[model samples]
Target: MNRFEDKIAIVTGAASGIGRATADRLRSEGGTVVGIDRDPVDDVDMAIQLDLLDLGAIAPTVAQIVDAYGRIDVLCNVAGIGHFARDEDETPEAWNRVIGVNLTGTYFMSQACLPHLLESQGNIVNTASTAGTNAQAWSSAYSASKGGVIALTQTMAITNGRSGIRVNCIAPGGVETPIGEQFTPPEDVDLTLMAGMLPYHRPAQPPELASAFAFLASDDASYCNGIVLRVDGGTMA
Candidate 1:
């Protein structure tokens, strides 16, 4: 199953969770993967310590990947943060931090990798969330950023399809990861609204969702573009 025998991929947020799972899946299938993360991690062929908040680091990071690989076949934007605050408790700094890393980071990385992706007729698979389309109790900032990612994925798909580059997204509902566990509602925050959010009533394992990422990036999805595939165990159904 060397679906990516000669492929080169760049996966952000590869330090852990879904990003790490996706990287492992691709590498197992024979792709050379360069992982990018804000923190220290050693999970791919090459690991780059990159904080998505640093807009200045995006281009050079892409350049380095391309310089080393000579081509880029896939870019997966899987690194994101979750924010859970009461409406009045949310601050400007907190909102900006979430938006900057999740939405802006996804955009900047896509822009930087577009040239190489176009060259290889590659694809981009972004990690969106069911929170984007559905509602979540304590996730205003997180939901908004994910919703923006959905729109961004569609825009990139439309803009780049003619150039033979594909852009799609996965809207995961409850995935067991560090970020997923980060959604902590205060003691006063009601959990009733969120209780109706998950139909499966269980968080998906990282590797389970990783399979979807692999599918979207592979040639099997050659005709898929701008599609936001929901892997949320009927959460959006």
Candidate 2:
């Protein structure tokens, strides 16, 4: 239970939802969690106001954490956005925003944190979605970005596993989070196209997803690199 005792962690989107729960869980288990989000994060050990879309701010943010905590043992790239629309309704701006935050931001955060993680032989737990592995209509941008996250997770695991860094991702089905508000389907969208995306069970709570994140980041998953562990209640099975 105290797998993170004396460890330091960085969790993006820690202001709310799964990120907030993950931060709380890790800190409860004895990790010093540095919460990052554009919004205020008062719950974690340390809070940093950061917008992941501002890629240039990432390194400085990581530097600040290192200066304060000395080292980072885990990096949870949990921040992301989603936009839903029919193909014709999808605008370039929406597409870019989704991909930029979900994919590009995750990459840069990993880049900024890798050296510290390597020094600590730490790991990364990313938040990918079932939509990434399974096609979901009206979620083109979200799917593409999460798919990129899965690929990025695997590539990082392969590139760093021998060096003692493990990278894994969780493909969640549906979680009770405010992010759903951002992806309201277009009024004319076909209902049947998305009906299959529903979970067999009710959507998970934020704490449920946090448990999985905790497991992957803990030493107990020493051999779980490059794995996409689906937390979707058999939705994809």
Candidate 3:
């Protein structure tokens, strides 16, 4: 139960949904969690309202964590935005926003945390999506950004392996989070029809995805470097 006992963790996008769930789960499993998000939230040991798109804010945030916790044992890159725009309809602003938060944010944050993580020989668990692996209609930006995360995870894992740092990614399907809710079919969209595409016949719960994250961050996954663990409930199986 105390898999992360005495460990210091940094979880981004922790104000709500999957990120919030992961933060709570990590703390429950004994990690001292420092959460960051653009919005404010309660229950985190340290919560910072930070906009991930503002890359300049990243290093300062990481410095704050290092100043407080002394080291970061786990870094979960869970901050991201969803874009449901079609290829043609997607504007430059939308593309930038989605890529900025989902991809660039992960890069900047990881870069900032690399030194501390190297000191702790820590691990990173990134929340990618099935869209990263498979094409998602009307979600080009989200898919591309997530794909970048997957690539980034592998690159970091390989680059940091000799240093005893592990990096892995989780590709979740449709989970019952605020982001998932946003994808709900319109009034004209048939729920029954949509249900048939998923093997589980329902969306995943945040806790389910969080559990996978917890495992990846724990010693249980000590050999799981550079891997993409899909938590899509057989949706991609």
What TM-score do all the candidates reach, one by one?
A: 0.97, 0.98, 0.93
Candidate 1, 1-237: lDDT as tens digits: 789899998899999999999999999999999999988767589999999999999999899888888999999999999988888888999999999999999999999999889989999999999989888877799999999999999999998899999999999988888885778776766678767676575679999888999999999999999999999987677
Question: Which TM-score value belongs to model 3?
Answer: 0.93
Instruction: Tell me the lDDT of model 3 at 11.
Output: 91
Clashes within 3 Å, all models in order:
0, 0, 0
Which tens-of-lDDT digit does each residue in 119-231 have in candidate 2?
99999999899989989888899999999999999999999999999999999898889998987878976788778888787889999999999999998899899999999
Which pairs of residues have clashing backbones in candidate 1?
Answer: none
- The full ranking of all candidates by lDDT, starting with the best, is 2, 1, 3
TM-score of 2: 0.98
> Per-model C-alpha lDDT, please?
0.91, 0.92, 0.87
| Model 1, C-alpha of 128: deviation from truth (Å) | 0.3
Weakest ten-residue segment in model 2 by summed lDDT? 188-197
The 10-residue segment of model 1 with minimum total lDDT is: 193-202
Residue 198 error, candidate 1, Å? 3.6
Q: Give the worst 10-residue stretch by lDDT in candidate 3.
A: 181-190
